[model samples]
Target: MKKYLQIVDRHKASLGTRFVNNFIDTIILLIINFILSFISAVIYNVTFIHFFYFYNNGGFLWNVFMGSVFGFVYFFFWENFTDGRTPGKYITGTKVISTDGKKPTTRQIVSRSLYRLIPFEAFTFFGTDGWHDSMTDTRVINYKNYESERQLKDEINSIGVKETA
Candidate 1:
């Protein structure tokens, strides 16, 4: 409703905040990929020295594919488990919510994560929203600001109502 828009409009995450969230999450993902790659190499009889360099073009591409897969899973579970907050979102003070100003459903989280696997999806942020957000009808917001605004709205709404004791 009108009150919902007021809170969301004032606290929606900016592109810059989104960028920071992605940056932090990507770094964490990279570290995870590195560790996994090393473990895989060890299981396959490759020496640690070769870990720094993939042996073939396919290996490089495999890493990229796995990275995307892991990223999807990470986004999905983190959002669902933490009420729309990933480690990056938490660090950046942001949260994801449905367009109607409610917590996103499991389907929304899954769809949002899947859309991220699209090529060049990050580039969508150049406009009003990223594909993952727009396609899933979700928005990332400044968590503290959104919560405060929502609290104020709740208080205002209760002002003219009679209490039932």
Candidate 2:
């Protein structure tokens, strides 16, 4: 609706905010990976030393693949279950929604998550929105005062209706 567009246009998130969110999220992911990898190494050392060596030797590409898998799961579940607000988004005071200014469906969240797999998707923030957002037809907006804005919009609408009456 026009009101939704007005709100969205007025509260579009900046690229810097998006970048900071991603930076924080990546740090979280890296911390998680480090802990898991450490645990795995210890387990392998105790059970099968040779297998541990093989796993560690799998090298950079293997690490990247594993990281990508983790990233996909992390983003998908967080966005889907949290109504498009991840830990990073929470910190940044932003939330994702459909381009039409409604909550995104499960399918849309999944599509957005999958798009994160694309190389350099983070850099796409230089444009209006990120690649994940663009591909899924979603947007992230400044949500620090979303409730207040919604209430104000509702009050304004009510006033308009009363005037018409």
User: lDDT per prediction?
Assistant: 0.84, 0.82
**Model 1, 1-165: lDDT tens per residue?**
312454665678998899999999889888887787667666557454543345222466876786788999888889999999988899999999988888999999999999999999999999888999888878999989888878988999999899999
| RMSD (CA, Å), each prediction | 4.0, 3.6
Clashing pairs in 2: none
lDDT of 1: 0.84
Q: Top lDDT: which candidate number? A: 1
Instruction: Give the true-structure RMSD of model 1.
Output: 4.0
Instruction: State each candidate's clash count.
Output: 0, 0
Q: Candidate 2: misplaced stretches above 4 Å?
A: 1-4, 49-55, 160-165
CA lDDT, candidate 2, residue 53:
57
lDDT of 2: 0.82
lDDT of 2 by residue, 1-165 (tens): 322355665677887888888888999998998888777789788898775655566689988888889999999999899988999999989998876778889998889888899898777877777788877778888886665797888898888464633
- For model 1, the stretches where C-alpha displacement exceeds 4 angstroms are 1-6, 46-58
